[model samples]
Target chain A: MRVVKTGIAGTLESSDVMITVSENTSTGINIELHSIVEKQFGKQIRKVIKEKMEELDISDATVSVNDKGALDCTICARLEAATYRAAGIKHVRWEEK
Target chain B: MEKLRRTMLYVPGNNAGMVKDAHIYRSDSVMFDLEDSVSLSEKDSARLLIFNALKTLDYEGIETVVRINGLDTPFGVDDIKAMVRAQPDIIRIPKADSADDIKAVEVLIEKEEKLAGLKVGTIKLMAAIEGPLGVLNAYSIATASKRMIGLAIGAEDYVTNMKTKRSPGGVEILFARSQIVTAARAAGIYALDTVYSDVNNEEGFLEEVRLIKQLGFDGKSVISPRQIAPVHKIYTPSQKDIDFALRVIEVIKEANEKGSGVISLDGKMVDKPIVDRAERVIAMAKASGIQFDEEDDK
Candidate 1:
């Protein structure tokens, strides 16, 4: 679940969110979210990202998202895609233990 | 259950925006495409995205179909594995040439259904006969499994196999289209015509729809949202046809009650096939939101 390299997923297209996970020297996870709906759904979006990162046991990485009004499922999917790419994993087993 | 499939819209599997909002368009079926629409590197991403979208998004009871890559590609097995778990109404097999192609995917679907604890045979199959071999074996492919609900002609690959490009008149694909429709009819399944790629040409699209309707296609596969209403309009039974069908059903019911085998309407003899067609017209009319009271006939 370690971030081995810079991994990016998703697109900047409307209803999609672009996520990037890269190495960070900071002690804790750092997230920077840029979204038009930041005033309203920002907290929830960040919570989703953080929860996915935590599920992957990723505690220390710099994550950035440029969201274009993506839904909760899209956000989670993009996060999972970026996380798998960052961990150098090719296939994702969503049901895996 | 015979569902209305007049307009099956193809949305790229990788596009989250389209997937989330597809139901709003009211297409008879929203086909999440994982085949030609997706590039090589994005196959996995598209599959995963579609899986999650199916699990989370509400298609509002619209039929959800996914066109998976051919088994020749490495991605096909994984696509089936993931898609079957998501439980779409139908899985469209691309470039399917023979019964074996459908059976192979059915085997995988069976395994996935068991592993996922889904009802066996819950997911139906549709085949896209895209090449010459596929067209030649259309009937076998259409009847290969009980799970198959429809057969569609993919004209792009078909015309290429014929060494020609698509013309406005569509002379090259007439044979293939006819063959597919006949086979689907023989198999008692639906026959869906391929997409009209030129979304901007309203005249050309309507003309093609008219041709397919004349050729007895049950429905069509559509690429864009704009094509939906036109196809549905062309497929919906007219008011006259609906009225005739209701009268036919009423007469047939009366004849049955009287223990009579022969039925006639409007000085014309009515038989089983005619009654079947009439029933189909009423079904189409009802599906298209044309309401009529059956109690009125009583």
Candidate 2:
């Protein structure tokens, strides 16, 4: 899998990610994503990130995401995660700080 | 056979006015749709509205269910988490194709239940069988989760995926409908026929409902309130039918008291299964507030 770092610069407190996916005739990608934020707003934050990802129009790819107190910039990481999954790279892990 | 529901009106989660007036329509079950009815931009807001509505409103004997987004989508997981927290009587999952899909949902349901501090398995689920693959795997999907109380066909999505046209009386969906009902019955769960989309075609609508009931579906998923009265009318047991059912139950009970496993009623054999059907009829009568004879109990 190849990793491309495409970033969005904005004052938005959340992250934005844009990606394109291509896969071969072999194995498919399995992508899983999760986000952990302040418990007070964890549910709301998760809802927002998920809504964005669902809005993304992509097929033939599996995307997994994990969130840890991520702002709008986290969208880049999500795209990266999706890219990695699409490319069949399994070693890279996303962690929450 | 169960009471028929000709109209299964769908209300979007974000529509407050529709939600408020839903009960007055008196459909069999109000499906608070959060899947296609919701746009990605408004999922969060929609969830909040549905949550608040389920929490505060009284539907007066109306069954409540929420149709979550497909598991393949990001919104799907979040939809389940939020609605599960609110605890609707049932969570309807869309685009399910296999037992694995049901199991995958069960895992997430368990986690969400823990987060919400609710007992595991407290909430029930229904699967909407939409594609050919889903139809093929109907039996496995029905049995995949003990939480699954029923199975429903999704005609709009299924027809689109199969690239077929919707014919009058839903001839295109007839085969899938048959397979689903057979599967649901084999698994001992309710089989719900898909929505009749042509709201203005009442004659076509009732005809379809009759065909579905004849096919042994427990009920139907409706799309409009106007269709509900007809569906209920068709499914409700007639007085003559109810009277016969009661007699069958009485003979079965007497035989059981005498340690006989079966009995004859009006020259036909009767057993526990026959009595069970009678009980359902009685229960339906009670739920629908229909009057029945007190002597039938004996």
Candidate 3:
């Protein structure tokens, strides 16, 4: 799996690691996610994100996530972050456009 | 009636081998499906087989639910009529578009219950909002029936109806899932994510489960027996979570004893929301078969 950075700043929160996908590609996705806050919760990060992706049919890419200090909600936010970046949605910049 | 903490394995109503062996698979819930899995001709036999399995099989500690046909279908009424007689733990009504659909089923269930001399509310209800109309009307469906314990999406159907092809990482149904979760939570009911159909793709299924849980779903539906263990493994509360939950409970108890509405813990406010979250952790722990102290409940 290639981590293609769309060079977008869709950082949902500084504390959370976010990943997004480009909206144009709709295929099938595979993701393997792990959390660092508690290693035992490794499976949790994977399970939650997988369900969200499939329910939404995000299959154009495979996402491998290694998370540190993340909660249940952050997993979604981060995945959305990656998705938004890939979708080419412009992030709010510090300077007016 | 137990909290569905692990996998809900879906067994095709027509597949007797899978149905018989399903008990040994060790799922928290076994949903014998009468939808999608069975063809139109097999509906009657499938219903009979499911009824027999419910009546005869020894599904120890496994919640047995029948995914009945939609209210609009001819088999929908028959499926409920026969399955309700068996009195499974939960009745999963598929393709429910509104509260009216659920209410009609509830009335039928009540009628069946009375006829069978069972309790009026014996069988809990769950609806699968599978279409665009259903997704938009999720709230009404959830609140329509008191018998409803959960709401789920028919991912395949929803995807087809939306006419959006799958993306590699799954970005399409995000809005619908979030909507269902919000509606379910608002209605004070359990929200279940749809099945991950590709059984061979373990990594894909795991990621989806994680996302659904993050989206605030209580559990997920699995199409194969192999999917159950992984889902259960993820849902099992971690030691750290258990410890924190216990601590939260302890602090809340201290505050409660002192006539305080809130307490301080870990340098954060422990109000109702915090306490409620802690309670959820404990509840999930309990359902996961994790050990904890009675004082863990403030």
Per-candidate DockQ vs. reference: 0.57, 0.02, 0.01
By DockQ thresholds, what CAPRI class is model 3?
incorrect
Model 3 score (lDDT): 0.73
Query: For model 3, how does the per-residue alpha-carbon lDDT over B38-76 read when each residue is reduced to its tens digit?
Result: 888556555655665676667886888899988787778
Clash number for every model?
0, 19, 42
TM-score leaderboard ranking? 1, 3, 2
TM-score of chain A by itself in each prediction: 0.93, 0.34, 0.57
lDDT of 2 by residue, B1-298 (tens): 2443334578876555666567888887888998898777546545555665676678886778899887898677777777777778888989889999989888998988887778999888889999999999999999999999899999988988889978896878988999999999999888898888889989998898889988988788877777888888888878887788778777777787898865788787776677888887777766566765677655
lDDT per residue as tens, model 1, A1-97: 7888988888899999999988898867899999989999999999998897888799999899999999988988888788788889887673442
Candidate 1: chain B TM-score against the reference chain B: 0.94
Locate the minimum summed-lDDT window of 10 residues in model 2 chain B: B1-10
User: How much does each candidate deviate from the true structure in C-alpha RMSD?
Assistant: 1.9, 12.3, 21.8
Model 3 misses residue B6 by how many Å? 3.2
True contacts kept of each: 0.45, 0.00, 0.00
Instruction: Give interface RMSD, every candidate, in order.
Output: 2.1, 13.1, 24.3
Native-vs-model 1 lDDT?
0.89
lDDT of 1 by residue, B1-298 (tens): 2578888998998998998998888989989999999889888778878888988888889999999999999899888888888889999999999999999999989987888787999999999999999999999999999999999999999999889999999999999999999999999999999999888999999999999999999888888898999888888888888879888989999999999999899999999999999888877777788767869434
- Top TM-score prediction, candidate number: 1
Which residue pairs overlap in candidate 1's backbone?
none
